[model samples]
Target: MKYLVMVQGSQADYDALGGKASAHSPAWSEKELRAMSSFMEELNNDLAESGEMVDGNGLAAPAATRLVGLGEDGRPVITDGPYGETKELLAGYWVLDCESLERVTEIAERVLRAPAPEGSPVYPVVIRPIPDAGGGDV
Candidate 1:
């Protein structure tokens, strides 16, 4: 089976950091940044060696995103994001081909353990099964 492991982040959290660029900006000491990078690289290596990792990548900041909707005149209207009441944005994702949702959940939990800012709260991870060609969850 295949699933998308979503790493989510709250908009309030982003705003608290001043904005998108500043959120991932070099405000952190170089040592902190290097440690985070090394931790992720090691994690990704483990996943790859286990043959569970299909693909994974981080997304650009929300401020760089846009919301598209129809205007009153029936034209496409594009607005910058940091969108509505929903607080979370997808910070990153990993596609894993695994035997069960249980395994995927375990992987998600492990991802949550990756290095992050000190004092940061644990964030949510969404696990959704990918559809197979027959239009069913894989």
Candidate 2:
């Protein structure tokens, strides 16, 4: 089965855990950023070895997001960025091929416990299975 592991954090929480300013005014430290990248590489390597890694990447912050919606006239309206009221937003994601939901959960736990950039709080990680698109079997 395929699964998408989403990394999430609140804007306030993210700002509170500052490092180097990204496109945003504040960001994580270089050392911490390197650590995160290294951790991700290691995790990807492990998943590859296990034949479970499909693809993955670290994403840009949500402040740089763009939203598209329909205007009252039914024409497309492009917004500057996210407008959700929820505190938490998706930061990144990993696609995995796992044997079972239990296995996916295990991977999620490992990701959450992975080291963070110095001075930053651990962000929340969620694991969700990707539903089959109803195509014919591979």
| Candidate 1 lDDT tens digits, 92-116 | 8999999898999998888888765
Which pairs of residues clash in candidate 2, taking residues 3 or more apart in a chain or in different chains?
19-27, 19-28, 20-27, 20-28
Candidate 1 achieves a global lDDT of: 0.76
How far residue 129's Cα lies from its native spot in candidate 2, in Å, is 1.4
RMSD of 2: 4.4
Q: How many residue pairs clash in each candidate?
A: 0, 4
At residue 112, give the lDDT of candidate 2.
84
- lDDT string for model 2 (1-138, tens) is 899999876555455445434343346666765786788889989999999999887666667778889999999999775456755688778899999999989989889876664445566678877878895234
lDDT value for model 2: 0.74
**In candidate 2, which residue ranges exceed 4 Å CA deviation?**
10-27, 82-86, 117-119, 135-138
